[model samples]
Target: MKHKSLAIPYVGWMALFVVAPLILVVVYAFTTREGGFTLDNFSNMVQYAGVFGRSFLLAFLATLVCILLGYPLALLLAREQSRLRGMAMLLIMLPMWMNFLLRTYSWVFLLERNGFFNTLLETVGLPKLDIIGTPAAVVLGMVYNFLPFMVLPIFSVIEKIDPRVIEAAQDLGANSAQVFRRVIFPLSLPGVLSGVTMVFIPSVSTFVISRLLGGGMNLLLGDLIEMQFLGSAYNPHLGSAISLVMMVIVLVSMGLMNRFGEGEGEAVLL
Candidate 1:
């Protein structure tokens, strides 16, 4: 009874903040401005298919890049001594301590035409690169902000792997490559799933990064949703419908990833 009582506040909090908002969003999504039920809001989504496609594509690329970069770093960090690992983690987390808006805004100055990056290149007698206002810039911003999310999960998982398991694999005449391929990689799937979910969802839904770095040229689903509610679009019903669709897609993607992780774990056991 005490434990149940202790959970009352948390349950109430979730019900008020999370459940209530979701219910409101659903109501708004399925109704017109005059409070009449309608499916036209969802039907209107066809016009913004490009926005959805671009958001998913850029997010996929960013997630892929994070995996390529973060996995190796995580592996290295997991093998390092505690002292070095602590310092490395501090450096990795240092940028996160600052305001997120400020961190993202700082990149605008760095990537703008004739900004720090191009000026540095010019000084080095290299051709100036046009990165800002482009998809590349948006992707770069996503990777920079979300790479830590990818690294930390995998590192935590790899660090927790029992050393004795690796030793047993070696004793069975497994080479370093074989052990990693058969043992380490399979065990780390959960972390990779976690990292992918963390990075992909935010990357797909990020308006600030796309707005600031993309210079208004690269519109994502988040930007579109924002425009609907706050910009000239001014349609909360449409925004809610878009949000609902995006939420459904994200849930489906997460479900597929979870299934894949479970299948991989089973394969390893077999």
Candidate 2:
């Protein structure tokens, strides 16, 4: 009872910071220009559906990229023992130690017209690709930043798996590919869902990646929200509406993952 009482302050802090902000968003989503509660904010989201659609598409692609890059890295890390896994974790997380903006700006430095990547292509007599200020750059930034998030959860799931399960399958005449297909892959679904969720929500809401890396275009809902909040439009109500739409999408996505992605053997890969 005493320990529970001591933990009340921590719980209160969580409510103040996390719960309060979320409640505010929900409340503001229903607020009107006349400062009355209404569904107009949500209705206003119809005007910006194009932007939200594009943002979800971008986030989905970015999460896919993270899965492609992170899954193998996670598998490699999972194969390692205690000390080696710790070292690999540190290496994977080293980039995250830097500020997110700084890391994103580093991509700007690398993807600029005359950046090192282009310079190297020039030296090799290859055509320099234009990537910055495009959706590609936004995807790059999202993948780079969220890859660690993808890896950690998948690695956790992969590492927790019993090695004997795979060995048992092999003894039953299963090959490496079969062992993975029937055994290891299913066990890793929870982690995959977790990684995708982690990557998608932030990538969808990140104006910075689009602004700094995507060269400030009409490629995402985040940019639209920023314009609504800070630009000439300056309708907090509409911005809140758009934010609420995003929140719904995120919630639905998470719910789907939770419902279908809880068990490894339950993944229905079409």
Candidate with the greatest TM-score versus the true structure: 1
State TM-scores per candidate: 0.96, 0.90
Candidate 2 per-residue lDDT, tens place, 125-157, comes to 999979989988889899999899899989988
Candidate 1 lDDT by residue in tens digits, 163-220:
9999999999999999999999888887888888889999999999999999999999
Model 2 TM-score, 2 decimals: 0.90
For each candidate, the alpha-carbon lDDT, in order, equals 0.92, 0.84
Q: What is the lDDT of residue 84 in candidate 2?
A: 82
- Where does model 2 exceed 4 Å of error? 81-87, 262-270
Backbone clash tally for model 1? Answer: 0
Residue 232 of candidate 1: its Cα lDDT? 73
